[model samples]
Target: MKNIPFISALFTPALIIIILSGCSRIYYAPTTQNVPLLTEQNELRIAAGISGGEEYEAVNIEVAYSPVKYVGIMLNSFHAAENSDSLFTNPVRYKGNLTEAGIGFYYPLATYYTAEVYAGYGKGTAQYPWSFDTIAPLKFDRFFVQFSAGMKRKYFEIALSDRFSYVHYTNIEEMYKIEAFSNYKYVPKNNQLYIFQEPALTMRAGLEAIKFQMQYQICIPFSGPTLGYSSYNFNLGIMLTPSVFFK
Candidate 1:
């Protein structure tokens, strides 16, 4: 009976330490991958939506146009942010944005199927709470190649896409000081490189000109440094093809 009290006393501190150490900070959040099913010239696709998972949310905008036969161009932007309730004594917050542009070729595989390939470059900045009183900002560059194929019907569409990306972190400020927090040990170091394979499934349903869209995506680490990042993403939004309405 006397030993019971001694065991509890020793275990209490260890349990607290474990709980505190388990808290992790997110350094990377994957954005929604845009998939536009273009089949011919003069086709345009515009989409705006909200995407999020686990610890963050984002506003996403995408535009794709086919100006010439089998030639397509696209632009995408994402603004993401997260603010968590206080952990221990301090709150954690993050703000970031990314922009990307790509050019690609698309072709119709069958009556309703289309296939496309694109390569793009992206740049982004992330600002997050590094310490109880300090926030650190980081910049990163990414290059990606994506392949997509889908079926488009009169009132519905479905697509599957896989994107491979290489990300490099730069302009890291105060990375050396991150070691002060034990929980943040998983954060990536300066000049780190990481390769990610992201695959997504997208669906849309509604009228011929406008439709409700949803996407589910997963991010997998392919190589290089690994850290705490959002691995899954869900997006809900609307897609518009103005040309269809006019036709």
Candidate 2:
């Protein structure tokens, strides 16, 4: 599936802003959640939610179906916007979308505890922020592995998850014009491989059909050629899930 454009597109402009603002960060870890809804035979689920922060925002939708007792197939899509600027420049905004599909397995570890694992891949496109004339030629391919454990109570549930991701950006030279970074001495040296890890804690409350969700996440970059990249990204979001499962 295809969709993850806005977050990818924001890279160039965000890089410029960060560099000009006296920092040298070139990577961002998109906000993602891991909530496994394992259904009974022939059951399906549909969920949507909105999430945001000072520099980025997103709308997400997901569909899942369980053909067996503990395994599920899932599909998801997102539209996101990212904005930033140097202290002296007006803010520049970038918008794009992404979609992914994956499979997950869940099992109970204890009376109130469960564990889950899932993986997915997706692609997206966005226009270069300099102008909308040409679509960004950057080729982005992403792969992720996630693990989660949670406890469920009568009306509330708490979950903790870790997501490991690898992303490769191809044909990066297309946007590597020297003029673009003339104002800054340091520029991204490698565009081929980026690695990130995110750990999140989530809580949900309410009945089966309607529930409220909130999450806090921290993103850590493991590998990159960089100077002063944000080691800890403070992130947060909220969501509401309706009709979690259809029997």
Best by lDDT: 1
Model 2 spans > 4 angstroms off: 1-27, 37-39, 85-92, 131-137, 182-191, 227-247
Global lDDT of model 2: 0.60
Task: Tell me the TM-score of each prediction against the true structure.
Answer: 0.86, 0.73
Model 1 over residues 150-176: C-alpha lDDT tens digits? 999989999999999888887665554
Number of the top candidate by TM-score?
1
Provide the lDDT at 196 for model 2: 80
Q: Write the per-residue lDDT of candidate 2 for residues 9-113, one digit (tens) a residue.
A: 869778756564452323243645646544344556555677664455677776766668788777877666654564422233455566777887888787888
CA-RMSD of model 2: 10.2
Clashing residue pairs found in predicted model 1? none
